[model samples]
Target: MRECIRCGEQMKEGCAIRVEGSATGIIMSTKENAMFSGRIGYPKVAICPKCGEVSIYVENVEKLK
Candidate 1:
Protein backbone atom coordinates (compact mmCIF):
# COMPACT_ATOMS: atom_id res chain seq x y z
CA MET A 1 0.00 0.00 0.00
CA ARG A 2 1.23 3.48 -0.79
CA GLU A 3 1.19 6.31 1.71
CA CYS A 4 0.72 9.98 1.11
CA ILE A 5 3.82 12.12 1.62
CA ARG A 6 1.97 15.26 2.56
CA CYS A 7 -0.79 13.77 4.65
CA GLY A 8 -0.88 10.58 6.71
CA GLU A 9 -3.38 8.80 4.50
CA GLN A 10 -3.43 5.64 2.51
CA MET A 11 -3.14 6.31 -1.23
CA LYS A 12 -5.07 4.71 -4.04
CA GLU A 13 -2.72 2.54 -6.05
CA GLY A 14 -2.80 0.71 -9.38
CA CYS A 15 -3.67 3.93 -11.22
CA ALA A 16 -2.41 4.69 -14.74
CA ILE A 17 -0.81 7.92 -15.91
CA ARG A 18 -1.67 8.50 -19.52
CA VAL A 19 -1.10 11.32 -21.93
CA GLU A 20 -3.81 13.94 -22.26
CA GLY A 21 -5.18 12.55 -25.51
CA SER A 22 -3.45 9.19 -25.68
CA ALA A 23 -4.18 5.75 -24.33
CA THR A 24 -0.51 5.01 -23.70
CA GLY A 25 0.72 5.23 -20.16
CA ILE A 26 4.03 6.50 -18.84
CA ILE A 27 7.07 4.25 -19.02
CA MET A 28 10.23 4.00 -16.98
CA SER A 29 13.58 2.53 -17.93
CA THR A 30 16.92 1.97 -16.31
CA LYS A 31 18.91 2.38 -19.52
CA GLU A 32 19.28 5.55 -21.58
CA ASN A 33 18.21 3.78 -24.78
CA ALA A 34 14.77 2.74 -23.63
CA MET A 35 13.51 1.50 -26.98
CA PHE A 36 16.21 -1.16 -27.34
CA SER A 37 16.50 -1.88 -23.62
CA GLY A 38 14.57 -4.68 -22.03
CA ARG A 39 14.75 -3.07 -18.64
CA ILE A 40 11.64 -1.01 -19.16
CA GLY A 41 8.26 -1.09 -17.48
CA TYR A 42 5.06 0.86 -17.23
CA PRO A 43 4.77 3.15 -14.26
CA LYS A 44 1.93 2.86 -11.76
CA VAL A 45 0.41 5.84 -10.09
CA ALA A 46 -0.84 6.48 -6.57
CA ILE A 47 -3.04 9.32 -5.51
CA CYS A 48 -3.80 10.64 -2.08
CA PRO A 49 -7.45 11.56 -1.70
CA LYS A 50 -6.75 13.60 1.39
CA CYS A 51 -4.05 15.95 0.16
CA GLY A 52 -4.10 15.32 -3.62
CA GLU A 53 -0.56 13.98 -3.60
CA VAL A 54 0.51 11.92 -6.59
CA SER A 55 3.26 9.33 -6.72
CA ILE A 56 4.61 7.42 -9.68
CA TYR A 57 6.23 4.00 -9.29
CA VAL A 58 7.10 0.86 -11.16
CA GLU A 59 5.50 -2.37 -10.05
CA ASN A 60 8.07 -4.59 -11.73
CA VAL A 61 11.04 -2.95 -10.05
CA GLU A 62 13.25 -6.02 -10.55
CA LYS A 63 13.17 -5.41 -14.30
CA LEU A 64 14.80 -2.05 -13.78
CA LYS A 65 17.85 -3.71 -12.25
Candidate 2:
Protein backbone atom coordinates (compact mmCIF):
# COMPACT_ATOMS: atom_id res chain seq x y z
CA MET A 1 0.00 0.00 0.00
CA ARG A 2 1.54 3.27 -1.10
CA GLU A 3 1.10 6.26 1.12
CA CYS A 4 1.35 9.87 0.15
CA ILE A 5 4.46 11.32 1.71
CA ARG A 6 3.17 14.84 1.71
CA CYS A 7 -0.42 14.38 2.85
CA GLY A 8 -0.20 11.09 4.69
CA GLU A 9 -3.13 9.66 2.83
CA GLN A 10 -3.61 6.32 1.17
CA MET A 11 -2.37 6.24 -2.39
CA LYS A 12 -3.71 4.27 -5.29
CA GLU A 13 -1.58 2.82 -8.05
CA GLY A 14 -1.93 5.10 -10.99
CA CYS A 15 0.28 4.70 -14.05
CA ALA A 16 3.75 4.12 -15.38
CA ILE A 17 5.95 7.19 -15.47
CA ARG A 18 8.78 7.38 -17.97
CA VAL A 19 12.10 8.68 -16.73
CA GLU A 20 14.89 9.67 -19.10
CA GLY A 21 18.40 11.04 -19.02
CA SER A 22 18.55 14.66 -17.98
CA ALA A 23 20.29 15.65 -21.20
CA THR A 24 17.84 14.02 -23.51
CA GLY A 25 17.28 16.07 -26.70
CA ILE A 26 19.67 18.73 -25.41
CA ILE A 27 22.77 19.20 -27.58
CA MET A 28 24.92 20.69 -24.87
CA SER A 29 27.54 17.97 -24.54
CA THR A 30 29.94 16.01 -26.74
CA LYS A 31 28.52 13.24 -28.90
CA GLU A 32 30.27 10.71 -26.71
CA ASN A 33 28.87 12.06 -23.48
CA ALA A 34 27.07 9.38 -21.53
CA MET A 35 24.92 12.05 -19.94
CA PHE A 36 23.37 12.83 -23.25
CA SER A 37 23.00 9.24 -24.33
CA GLY A 38 19.61 7.67 -24.08
CA ARG A 39 18.84 6.05 -20.74
CA ILE A 40 15.32 5.30 -19.75
CA GLY A 41 13.29 4.02 -16.81
CA TYR A 42 9.69 3.04 -16.44
CA PRO A 43 8.53 3.27 -12.83
CA LYS A 44 5.12 2.48 -11.56
CA VAL A 45 3.32 5.42 -9.99
CA ALA A 46 0.90 5.92 -7.15
CA ILE A 47 -1.29 8.92 -6.52
CA CYS A 48 -3.30 10.27 -3.65
CA PRO A 49 -6.67 11.26 -5.00
CA LYS A 50 -7.46 13.52 -2.08
CA CYS A 51 -4.29 15.59 -1.95
CA GLY A 52 -3.02 15.04 -5.50
CA GLU A 53 0.33 13.70 -4.39
CA VAL A 54 2.39 11.38 -6.55
CA SER A 55 4.85 8.58 -5.84
CA ILE A 56 7.16 6.52 -8.02
CA TYR A 57 8.23 2.90 -7.53
CA VAL A 58 11.19 1.29 -9.26
CA GLU A 59 11.33 -2.46 -9.00
CA ASN A 60 14.99 -2.70 -9.90
CA VAL A 61 17.40 0.11 -9.18
CA GLU A 62 20.29 -1.81 -10.72
CA LYS A 63 18.83 -1.15 -14.15
CA LEU A 64 19.99 2.44 -13.76
CA LYS A 65 23.58 1.45 -13.32
Candidate 3:
Protein backbone atom coordinates (compact mmCIF):
# COMPACT_ATOMS: atom_id res chain seq x y z
CA MET A 1 0.00 0.00 0.00
CA ARG A 2 1.13 3.54 -0.73
CA GLU A 3 0.69 6.57 1.41
CA CYS A 4 -0.02 10.02 0.08
CA ILE A 5 2.86 12.39 0.67
CA ARG A 6 0.67 15.40 1.06
CA CYS A 7 -2.26 14.08 3.06
CA GLY A 8 -0.79 11.05 4.75
CA GLU A 9 -3.65 8.97 3.51
CA GLN A 10 -3.49 5.47 2.12
CA MET A 11 -3.24 5.58 -1.66
CA LYS A 12 -4.86 3.35 -4.21
CA GLU A 13 -2.27 1.21 -5.91
CA GLY A 14 -2.04 -1.19 -8.87
CA CYS A 15 -2.89 1.55 -11.31
CA ALA A 16 -1.14 2.01 -14.66
CA ILE A 17 0.08 5.17 -16.35
CA ARG A 18 -0.35 5.50 -20.08
CA VAL A 19 0.58 8.00 -22.69
CA GLU A 20 -2.08 10.17 -24.20
CA GLY A 21 -3.45 8.74 -27.48
CA SER A 22 -1.18 5.70 -27.14
CA ALA A 23 -1.79 2.15 -26.01
CA THR A 24 1.75 1.79 -24.72
CA GLY A 25 2.46 2.94 -21.17
CA ILE A 26 5.45 4.72 -19.66
CA ILE A 27 8.79 2.94 -19.78
CA MET A 28 11.93 2.95 -17.66
CA SER A 29 15.31 1.79 -18.86
CA THR A 30 18.74 1.46 -17.35
CA LYS A 31 20.75 1.86 -20.54
CA GLU A 32 21.46 5.15 -22.21
CA ASN A 33 20.52 3.61 -25.57
CA ALA A 34 17.23 2.20 -24.34
CA MET A 35 15.69 1.73 -27.78
CA PHE A 36 18.16 -0.99 -28.78
CA SER A 37 19.65 -2.28 -25.55
CA GLY A 38 19.50 -2.46 -21.77
CA ARG A 39 16.79 -3.42 -19.35
CA ILE A 40 13.34 -1.92 -19.60
CA GLY A 41 10.37 -1.72 -17.28
CA TYR A 42 6.82 -0.43 -17.23
CA PRO A 43 5.93 1.88 -14.38
CA LYS A 44 2.95 1.44 -12.11
CA VAL A 45 1.02 4.17 -10.39
CA ALA A 46 -0.42 4.86 -6.98
CA ILE A 47 -2.98 7.57 -6.48
CA CYS A 48 -4.35 9.36 -3.48
CA PRO A 49 -8.04 10.01 -3.77
CA LYS A 50 -8.12 12.45 -0.87
CA CYS A 51 -5.56 14.96 -2.10
CA GLY A 52 -5.21 13.89 -5.73
CA GLU A 53 -1.59 12.92 -5.37
CA VAL A 54 0.01 10.47 -7.77
CA SER A 55 3.11 8.36 -7.36
CA ILE A 56 4.92 6.33 -10.03
CA TYR A 57 7.15 3.33 -9.52
CA VAL A 58 8.62 0.41 -11.35
CA GLU A 59 7.41 -3.06 -10.43
CA ASN A 60 10.17 -5.00 -12.10
CA VAL A 61 13.05 -3.24 -10.43
CA GLU A 62 15.29 -6.28 -10.78
CA LYS A 63 14.94 -6.18 -14.55
CA LEU A 64 16.40 -2.72 -14.70
CA LYS A 65 19.40 -3.77 -12.71
lDDT of 3 by residue, 1-65 (tens): 77899999999999987689988756677876774466566778999999989999877777655
Two-way lDDT contest, 1 vs 3, winner: 1
Model 3 residue 36 lDDT score: 49
Sort by lDDT, top down from the best: 1, 3, 2
Instruction: State each model's C-alpha RMSD to the native.
Output: 1.8, 7.1, 2.0
Sort all candidates by TM-score, best to worst. Answer: 1, 3, 2
Give per-residue lDDT, candidate 3, residue 4: 94
Q: Any runs in candidate 3 off by more than 4 Å, and if so which? A: 35-37
lDDT of 1 by residue, 1-65 (tens): 88898987999999888899887656666776765576567778899999899998888877755
Worst 10 residues of 3 by lDDT: 34-43
Supply candidate 2's per-residue lDDT for 49.
Answer: 87
Candidate 2 residues lying further than 4 Å off, grouped into runs, are 18-41, 61-65
Candidate whose lDDT is highest: 1
TM-score per prediction, in order, is 0.80, 0.49, 0.75
lDDT of 2 by residue, 1-65 (tens): 77789988988885655438664432222234563453343456888989988877764556456
